[model samples]
Target: MLDPRFLTIPITHRGLHAPGVPENSLAAARAAIEAGYGIECDIQPGPDGEPLVFHDYQLHRLTGAQGFIAATDAATLAGLRLLGTDEPVPTLRQFLDLIAGRVPLLIEIKDQDGACGPNVGTLPARVAEALAGYDGPVAVMSFNPHMIAAFREAAPHVPVGLTTCAFGEDDWARVPPARRDELAAIADYDAVGASFISHDKDDLDNPRVDALRAAGAGILSWTIRSLAEEQAARRIAQNVTFEGYRAAY
Candidate 1:
């Protein structure tokens, strides 16, 4: 049932790892390349409206900085070190250059809970611009269906997908009840024109995912942290967007 075009190869979530290379750092990307695995990274809008390769909404966890990632300009971000390491945050352009067509790159565009703030409205376009001349296999995805649609229009040649999970109690405060239900049910698949569905590993049993795969849509699962998890993912989803340990194919 897996879509061979994508899951045929292995993928590393936030790239390969080491003691020094933090997640989403350029060093992590290089580590993934050296290890011969497909690369995956998170993208967010920078203060200057450019797309930067970062994972969190805030910089405190990774950079020791005390502000939102959208609050700083790309130049300022380039100057700050990640996790106290000498390695600085790299832009999407820099990330693509490093990959250089050697392996496929999957980009997850981070969303701000459907709230348009700062440069958030223009993120899909900026990311498309960054991927313009890159000669490689690249794809974009987001939890926000609207953003996914935007990317489809902006870069029809590049495959776009929807990354989703079944919402539960913990998400109620942040997400509206009706909206949560819609996402949990994947109610926007056809409307968004998603080329793939990156469902949460725990929610892969959803019948909708199975339906999509039956229809020839790619199904990729995320954050697989162990061999056991990888094995489980293979039985259902096409690929594993993994981390915490190297994925052994």
Candidate 2:
């Protein structure tokens, strides 16, 4: 369970998108706010260096467009419609404006390594600028520890969370088993330095979660879709990520 002292809840993944609402679009965020749920969405830099809300490396999956999100400018992305909706790919600022202090926001920085890498250079600063003076609670989350570190430096007041996923046997097969603990320890340490840890549901059972909580770090779990998973997450975390089930408590 989340610490009763802090204002928090199970944030909706990509803002409560369902059969009607498009994931990561402004409409989805609006739906989340209308349902009184906190919003969690992804941020990536467009080719023109603007911050846009999107989750995938390529636009083809969500939008019918080819190439990566970073390959296009905001104007081009704005022209493309999101799947199942007429909503254009909205900028992070636009999404925030749509929410309009109705709910808190959890912004995730999506960075898959490549020529585009993560939006490391100016992304943090832009996000900070957009969030400046906003009254609602806001926390920045990222899979990349460096991005969290940069956010910490750029916006000291805004809380940051580190997102991690457990490795499977196939993952272990690629990397030596001996080094996994060392890497996990490093990530745990980094997460501790940040204000919170946003990990998968299974991570709640890990000793590191207790260790971080003991140190006063906030804990959050991601992408929970079932009642059983939500119950499990409630038992172990301060918050859980949600989608599809709007009426769920």
Give candidate 1 misplaced runs (Cα > 4 Å). 1-5, 113-120
Summing lDDT over every window of 10 consecutive residues in candidate 2, give the lowest-scoring window: 110-119
Model 1 earns a TM-score of 0.93
Q: Candidate 2 has what TM-score? A: 0.86
* Candidate 2: segments with Cα more than 4 A from true spot: 1-7, 112-119, 167-183, 186-192
lDDT of 1 by residue, 131-163 (tens): 887787788888878787777788877888888
lDDT assessment of candidate 1: 0.81
lDDT of each: 0.81, 0.73
- In angstroms, what RMSD does candidate 2 have relative to the true structure? 3.4
Query: Which candidate gets the maximum TM-score versus the true structure?
Result: 1
Q: After superposition, how far is residue 114 of candidate 1 from its true place, in Å?
A: 4.2
- Tens-place lDDT digits, model 2, residues 21-43: 78998888887777788888999
Instruction: Return the top candidate by lDDT.
Output: 1
| Candidate 1: Cα lDDT at 178 | 82
Whole-model lDDT for model 2 versus the true structure? 0.73
